[model samples]
Target: MNTLKWIKRILMALLLIIFLLLMAGFVFERISRSIAEKIKPDGQFAEVENHKMHYLQQGKGGPTVVFETAFDPAGHLQWYHIQQNLPKSYTTFSYDRSGILWSERGANPKTGEKMAEELHTLLEKSKAPKPYILVGHSFGGMLTRFFVQKYPKDVAGVILVDSQYPADEKYLSPQLYKMVNQGLPGGFLKFANTFGAARLMFKNMFPENNQYQYQNSVMPALLYKSADATLEEQDHMKSVKTEAAAINTFGSVPLYVITAGDKTKYDSFIKDQKIKNEMLGAWDKMQKDLLNLSTDSKQIIAEKSGHYINQDQPEVIEKAVNDMVEKVSVQ
Candidate 1:
């Protein structure tokens, strides 16, 4: 009788422990994050094409501007400051492309025209005033050209911020080609995988960067986006990526390319010296390619910045953007 009693007690204790752990995990996984609650982002949400998209809008008037972000989940977040600072002189639209923030998760490789097509639809749907300025940063910058080609009549101007060019592919050293052509995940990705790393990164250790660096609340969206990019549809992207390569190879675009003149911190993650050099080399390509893109184009080198140029130098980008905006007005 005593032996039976001890076994029963032990089993009961084990069961209780299991129950508690389950409850804790459930709480952690299901609970909404604090940051998600912080900003309402004041934009219309839509079930666009294969996925839902969250787009924020502010200001009012001519030159309706649309912002496309780099391939990050919280891409819209990167432009928060710039959006706030720009004179609502023209209405601005910043959206979470496909699998990005607040947007429903879905499969999509996210080609330039496909993305631009969605924006094309978004433009028609929003019924926002016409003559749009399609401004892209990094990958977003590439899309600006793609959008202009697809909707030649619709665009008023374009701004490329320290962005990749149509010819960026030509300069793609074998190493950089593996990184971008393979279309891997963004650099700060690990920051989303761990709580401790996220803490260090979110402390603004990186500028113009959201604190949720390691904690990607938007990954489900990325996975789905990558999964859904159809190969046939990607044919256009091949040309787009190729044009980017050619642009880099020969240099082209009625462009403004901002090069980050800063060096990487060369810590553990930063230890990838080959990667560091390749990225810098590619950065140099922006200047060369833009000159190739347009005779009247200008290249501004931003000092003390990383791949995330606008984050570190928003004022610099804003001034650059304003200059581009004014230049477009002149054109």
Candidate 2:
């Protein structure tokens, strides 16, 4: 009789704890949504296929500079510093991908081709004049490459900033590759977003300036809309490589490849210098190969920087884009 009573009491305590957690999660979610609503979007919107796409544009003229964000969910905000420094004579633009901050969730699969098509449409709808100079960072580089391949006539030049090579997986060890490709758990993110846990976690760690406000506003939205889309994009990695292989070259269309200089952190996760060196070598070789993509291409090493060159050395990106703009202007 005593044992039965104790068992019942323990079971009841467990149930109560679970109930409290669920309730707390619900309350946090409500608080997060309210905070998100108070934040204003940084840019204007363009309607594409009846969905609103958010974008920011500065300056005013021909051969518009279009910036694409890295794989990180922050979107156009990643280029905030570099974009601000560009000349006012030439138009510059940046935008969030579908399912990212300030953009409607897209129904189509998040493949490189689909993203490129959507970007093309967004520009057309937004009335961004043609003869564009596409500047892409990281995964955005792949999308920009796809855009150039599909609409070669519209693009005057390309700048890839610490971009992801299509065959990147081939250079990675099997263990590393598996770790890189493994998808984050969407359900956990969704739960965290619902409970405002993600918001609290990132609020303090956000970058300086006005970035904290931006990050706080969009962190939950990204968790809610982008978690699954990110996974879906990962699944299509092979297809991205295949498409890249098919394009082979970019002809003489003025390409600049900016590679990161700091390689000491490459294998920090595993704390293995050998693995890090190998990965860094592969990355350098890949960046060099990017030169083969264009007859007029060159590679610049951001000697003081890492993968996030825009943040580490915004001046480097500024110079590269300025140079590309000058090159296109003459041609």
Candidate 3:
């Protein structure tokens, strides 16, 4: 009877500790979220299918440049420098997709086509000047393909910045691909974030630079809905690849492909030199293949940069967009 009583007491104490930790985490999460809302940068919101989507727009007038972001929750951060430096005479727009950053979570099965449609609706509602010069990075490249294919009329030209190759899976080892896609499960991530684990882990990781500080400030909150959204995107990538492959060419549409030229960037992810070399070769081929999308297309290598050409070499993107804008303006 004494032994049994001791075991029972220990179990009860453990349960109580867990409950208290959960409550504390929940409280901290709520407080952080509230504070983040108050201090974060202001962005316009649009209702898309009963959920709010957040967006930032700079400059004004015709030939709008619409930026599509990669897998990160803070999507707008990808284009901050370029968007700010673009000519004020031309409009530039970037947004957090559904369930990312300030945007509210939406319905499930967030496929590429569905997202493209949502973007169209957002554009219609926001009244952003249309027939845009579309710019996409990483996963956003896949989205840009869907957008251009579904709403070809809304696109004047395209600029792919170190974009995801639909066939990337074939090049990368299974381990690397899984590592890249299968980040902590969305449910666990949300739970962890809600319980303040994510916040606690990354609180000190924020950059000191004021320009980018606010961008990183919102990350702890991002792992909630955005993690699920990212997983959904990864789960449905096969369909995305199939849909993107349907477009054999863009005909006369002006296209610019900015390839990240640093082959050594993958060295960290891949150990075997032989496999890394093969992957690098495949990447180069895939980038060059993007040029075939349009006869008017061109490719510029960001030799100093890795996957993030915008951050490493913003001038390459700015010059490409400016040149595309001029080309489209004449036509």
Candidate 4:
């Protein structure tokens, strides 16, 4: 009888502990989200598509330069340096991707081809110029690559930053590929898109192993916007197919590629010897593949910079871009 009573008490204690932890987590998430909402963009616009797209435009010249921060957590403000110092001759405008940062949600994949089409429509509606230089990072690189193929006559030069093409699916992990591939139709897209669902995912995934306070902004906050561009559930899949089709169409337009350097170089945090070796080996293989892919374009690796190479080595990116512009201009 005494033993049974002790077991019941222990189980009750554990349940109470779990309940307290869940409540604390809920409170912390609310606080973090309230903080990230405060960061502001340099300029803002309600795009012709009826979705708001944030932007920052500066300078003036022959071929206007447009920068796309189509990656996570950022709006138009991520171009802190390029907007400040990309030469006086070129007009530069950096903007948030739809469904990211301050922009209104619009679509999935947000391919360069579809985005380029939208921007072109916006340009026509807003009377924005054409025959401009295009710059993109990561996924944005895929977009720029597609734009050059789709509208070769409209682009003068292109610069792609730390763009992860030719790399295997290992970097993104099979699970993420599964989520993006499976969950779109599995219904996580519609459900987790609201601000509440996003807060839960971002906070829980913060993993006690890594620490980054949501002091300002988080990638998922971009989920607050609605996707007006998607008509059907599979429109997202169509976007993927459309982007793949665009890849089959790369043109001979002036091109520059920036290969990124991963920081497994100084990574002592990796405890397992086998995982460390695998990381180092993977980084070396990616470097070799990048060098081979840089044939027509000027390719340089940004050292110690991981996925967000532009944010890590923006000045290096800026110089490489300017050099490419001068070289292509002379050609």
Q: Could you say which candidate leads in lDDT?
A: 3
The collision pairs in model 4 are: 36-216, 112-143
- The lDDT of each candidate is 0.61, 0.78, 0.79, 0.57
Q: Give one digit per residue, the lDDT tens place, for model 1 in 156-243.
A: 6666676765555567677665665554233343323222223223334233335434324333323223222322233345566665
- Candidate 1 deviant stretches above 4 angstroms: 1-27, 33-41, 50-52, 105-109, 165-169, 179-240, 243-254, 265-279
Candidates 1 and 2, the one with greater TM-score:
2
Best by TM-score: 2
lDDT of 3 by residue, 137-217 (tens): 988976888888788887899999988877667666786566555544667666777787876665533345776665566
After superposing all C-alphas onto the true structure, candidate 2 shows an RMSD in angstroms of 2.6
Candidate 3 colliding pairs: none
lDDT of 1 at 276: 70
lDDT of 3: 0.79
- What residue runs in model 4 are displaced by over 4 Å at the alpha carbon? 27-39, 107-112, 122-128, 166-249, 262-296, 328-331
Give the C-alpha lDDT of model 4: 0.57
If candidate 3 were superposed on the true structure by all CA atoms, what would the RMSD be?
3.3
Kindly list the per-residue Cα lDDT of model 4 for residues 100-191, writing each as its tens digit: 55666654345555677766555444434556677777656656656666677878777777654533344435643343334233255444
Q: Comparing 1 and 3 by lDDT, which wins? A: 3
The TM-score-based order of candidates, best leading, equals: 2, 3, 1, 4
